[model samples]
Target: MQKYSTILLVGVVVILAATLAGVLVFMKNNPAQERALLPLVEIAPMEPDSAKWGVNFPSQWNSLQKTETNNIDTAYAGSSAFSWLERDPRQVILFAGYPFSKDYNDDRGHMNALEDVRATKRLNLNDEDPKRTPATCYSCKSSNNPGLWEEMGMAEYDAMSFNEMTPNINNAIGCSNCHEAGTMRLIVTNPALNEALEAQGKDWTTFTRQEMRTVVCANCHVEYYFDGPGKYLTFPWTNGTRVDQIISYYEEEGFSDWTYPEAGTPMLKAQHPEYEFFTAGSTHYNAGVSCADCHMPYVRDGAAKYSSHDVHSPLINPEQACGQCHTDVNYVVGRVATIQEQVAVTKIAAEDALIDAINAIQLAAANPNADAALLDQARALHRKAQFMWDFLSAENSTGFHNPEYALKICAEATNLARQAQMLAAQSVNDPSLLTTGTYYTTP
Candidate 1:
């Protein structure tokens, strides 16, 4: 009887072991289900129309569509497409010779990129003119870029006139602008950004997923210049992304977007440089926070939780945006307001200084008897001062990205402008160039 009971126990143990082994094998062969483990439809690479990609990600697409109509206003910036030129007329004189001075409206949002670019008064639609806008302007305005760039090469694509290239660009920013269709992972979709990263000896592929969130924004939100006759898009990160470093790089290349009218100083027009500003050793960045962390906070819908696709100011949704890191959301929002206001006021001071410098330089240039060498020195200083100021002015964040850095740059810019004005006066042996409040007193 004892031997029979022992035999039954041994048989049960053998059966359980075999079943466990089979379960382990099955689990190894079949992985657990994740968010849409298999696509209901296979998306083609570089699909420009977002609706096709929306088939796989309805929530993100639906959320993204809201940007088209959600034109909310914040204290400094929002999606209302307000004319920045009207809000700050100082920019008019600052950018006098550039197209931006004529028409500089705040961007409506990502969804309206194509429409806004088409409508901007700055665009010279005449294809026959050599100074007309090129297809390079479409670099950040369309989802169709990746495929077009792949087929045509960026050099050839940018070589075409904007009017000539308009037919090919049909979609505004979409999933393909920043994602891989095959894996649905964030990627460096802009070839210019890819090459810039390489120029810095950094590989975007080796970057971690979190890093990609911020770096991906660099695709469109960076300060770039059109290189050479091809009007090829290029980021000025070869020297380093700092404001001073960027000035050095531009000086080395002897590049200027346009010559400041009357002032005769070569000037740089800063494209929105949100990426460079935010990544320049900010507190949030050091804390491992990303641009998307504040701008694209995660929200829950039923059982699904995903980062909200309606990208905008964090002040628009402080609870979901600032509440994630800071315990006091309201306090943080208040801080942003205070910081932005301070920066705005300080920025105006810098602008005033720049105007004075331009005024002095203009006087000096008009004086043929003025020491040519001294006049050239004044022009160089004016160029550096104005570019530094524009870097902060065009950043779009109103200096909240890095308040200390912003103020530091502003102070430096003001000093440079004053020095430029003094040099201009010394060149002509006249103190008239040292006049202040020239803008207020003029016209």
Candidate 2:
């Protein structure tokens, strides 16, 4: 009877242990379902002061403060201050008709948007000038944009100049820029982007969180141009996001920013499309990475976790930004450095070739008996070549994104420009006695 009782006790203990194990496994696998009953964190928009926003989201705000540090560098664009105009003067000619040609600088952090715009000489707005610049300019530079647009309507917002609306649009790029006021949920405030997406049969409402992470930045970092007299903001992606597709759209619509005096070609200026170029690269394409993946890495502070919003180069903090996924800091650094070097070399070569082509076209244009057909051929070549150059060069960090793709674009651009020049010369009746005309264009 004692032996039977002992056996019964052992069996009971085993059953209890088995039941406990099963419960643990169930909880592990169904964590989401268990968490579904928990209360949600309430997040609301604070005053325009970034400090107040920081109180609610300390991690995001603290990370954002890092943008003040301008020492980091990556394969391409970073937090460092760069004189974009001095880097390549050929841009002056390429953007001869646009405000960018006058003065353009590399984008720093969102924190600098308001001050940078005010300090940059390109706008030419005087303190006393009551006529403010177009409200369209503020679209990408602030979170208050949506609030203002919603309150005043698009027409009223566009009608007001910078000086006129300075007091009202005080908030620079911040939480409100990409999120709803009370919920902090991602929202699309840009009408132009929404329209473009709809035109392509895409529903912006259904964009996944991964897409939104990048699209939020795409709100500002994209290729855009002002349309009509109201200077309504526009993105050229109505047809598609490729170079040729955008060019075709521009051609079909007869859009021309300004006519170049030297080359005598109507030119279309290409804005910074960082997100667009990133989307085309392997990091984004294959790895399913977003701008936030590199720019805004996650950080843990004690028990709290939040995304770092110091949007800059991942190269600065490879261990946190990329090494977490890649596992080898040295390998990631080497890859980025090699890509940057290759892009720089390719860019220099392409620029040299472009300069030569531009000079040749200018010479052809100056000729008194320049055959109309020959001149047209030269102009077409210059246009195509310029577009290619712009596409490759506009990407601040080229090879880092995709070395092979970047090099190919540069090589193709160089060839196109050279061929265009050669074809122009051949079209002329006299090939041997081509005399150089005045070279007044500054590069």
lDDT of each: 0.89, 0.70
| Model 2, span 1-443: residue lDDT tens | 99999999999999999999998887665433222333244444433556666665666777777776666654467776677778766667667666778887777877878877777666746645532366677777776777777777767777666666777877678877776655556777777778777888888779888888888777777888777767778888888876677888888877877776777877766777676667765555567787787777766676555677777777777888886678788987887888787788777677666666666667667777677787777777677667766776776666676567778778887887777676556555555323322222323
Q: Tens-digit lDDT track for model 1 on 227-293?
A: 9988999999999999988989999999999988887888888888898888889888888999999
Q: What is the lDDT of residue 66 in candidate 1?
A: 87
Clashes of 1: 0
Tell me the deviation in Å of residue 3 in model 2.
Answer: 21
Say which candidate scores most in lDDT. 1
**Cα-lDDT of candidate 2:** 0.70
Off by over 4 Å in 2: 1-49, 73-76, 126-133, 281-283, 430-443
